[model samples]
Target: MDNTTTEDTSDTEEEILVYAEFADSVNIEKYNSMHILGIDTKTPIVQMNETFFTGTYENPLGTYMFFENDTSPQSTDPVFDRIPEKNVKYVCKTRKLLKVEHGYITPKDGSGQSTQNQAQQAQEDAIKMVSFKTVQEALDKFKQEWCTNESSSTDNNINNLKES
Candidate 1:
């Protein structure tokens, strides 16, 4: 009773060149969009893609191209020359957990009693760790902190607070 054809599966694996924005550094707001060999290659497409959108979805910072396993002479495009021959995987497909830690001192310890000080210190040491199954989940957590709507400032402020 299977109606699905092999074409469906083929489409998923078919390799096509993809141009995407990648994060230049840890800052999420910074991105370098470029054209690269697609997921079909042995490149780390997952990691590259994650880096592209790691921080904010604001604007592109620059442009860069990466091609793995290419030994030929450099192309006229300067971006193409940036590609490294070894360890050029652009994406990571591994299922790894992303962890974020948060900690805060208790405000009730304003009097600064010895016991309260100890408790406050302990509370600060007690970090809350959140793990995400995917990079998108992690990105979403950051996106949730900001107002995405341009028309409604009130709604933006109300929902901008960090979720408990």
Candidate 2:
């Protein structure tokens, strides 16, 4: 008899207990705070008598309201009654997104080709290719050259090499 009574009381207590928070997301980082909305603290709800707060803990304002995690506030829910909080996690502050504009694919018009392309044809034109051997020779020529300043001096060292 006592076991049956305990089960009935436990069921009623579970139904009434509601836990919530001002959450940025319902992810692993849900502990992070968001805007706070304080419930009607001045006049408690006649039945529940629970003070529910909305918004962040720092800034508790009643401008907005909150509902349970699973219960979403819908157009169908009647007034002076309970509604659900389905999208509690969905709202990001990167929140209340009005619209998302995505970049559209450009038409394959002749004017709209890659800048590197010689023509707007489907394929790119082949470029002139230089051989590695030719490039190395050019580099060697530059490295071997002695870049002397064109100093205006008329000094002649050993006018001509004699057969000493």
What TM-scores do the predictions have? Answer: 0.19, 0.16
All models, RMSD in angstroms: 24.5, 21.1
| Candidate 2: worst-modelled 10 consecutive residues by lDDT | 94-103
lDDT of 1 by residue, 66-160 (tens): 44553454556896556455534443232222221121235554565877888989999998888999977886775665435434674455456
Residues 4-107, candidate 2: write the lDDT tens digits.
44444454332222223323333324334433222223212211122222322223232233343545346554766565444453322212111111223456
For candidate 2, give the lDDT: 0.33
- Least accurate stretch of 10 residues (summed lDDT) in model 1? 94-103
lDDT of 1: 0.44
Candidate 2 Cα outliers beyond 4 Å, as residue runs: 1-99, 111-140, 143-164
Relative to the true structure, candidate 2 reaches a TM of 0.16
